[model samples]
Target: MPAVNRRLVTDYDLQDAMERQIGIRVFEHDHIVHSGGAILRFDDRTVVIQAGVSDLSYFNRADCEFFELKKR
Candidate 1:
C-alpha cells in the first residue's frame, strides 16, 4: 500500500472507484476497519466490500469516514 492520493468523499467518487475495480481500505474514526477488499458496489447509502472471493461486507455510507485507494 502506498500513500492515498484520493479520498472518496461522495457517492459519485465511490461509484467511480467501484467501476474502475479499485481496491480500497475503509476507515472509521481514523481507524482502519476494512482493508484488502475490492469495491464491489456502492450507492447513496451503502458500500459493499468483497474480501477474497465470497466474503462480502456491508457498511453504511455514514459509518465510513474515509475511503482510500490501495495501490495494486
Candidate 2:
C-alpha cells in the first residue's frame, strides 16, 4: 500500500515562521526540544532544526509526525 500525507494548522505555522522570518520553539520526537533560535532553515524535503550554538538536525515533515510550539 501507498502512504498518505497530511498537514495541520501547526505545520502551517511552522512554514509561515520560516517564510515570515519569525522564530518559534519546536517540540520534536525522542523528547527533543528546540528553541526559537534553533530553527535554521526549511526546504521542500526537510526543516533544519538546530541545537546549542551550531549543532543542527534535519527533520522530514512527510511522516505526519506532530510537533508543538512552546508557550510564549
Q: Give the C-alpha miss distance for residue 30 in model 1, angstroms.
A: 1.8
lDDT of 2 by residue, 1-72 (tens): 553322223556666655654444444464444444534676566777655577776767553243434324
In model 2, the runs with Cα more than 4 Å from the true position are 1-12, 16-37, 64-66
Per-candidate clashes, comma-separated: 0, 0
- In the predicted model 2, the residue pairs found to clash are none
In order, candidate lDDTs are 0.77, 0.51
Off by over 4 Å in 1: 70-72
- Per-residue lDDT of model 1, residues 1-72, tens digit only: 556547888877887878777778878877888876777887788888888788998888888854666554
> Which predicted model would earn the best TM-score?
1
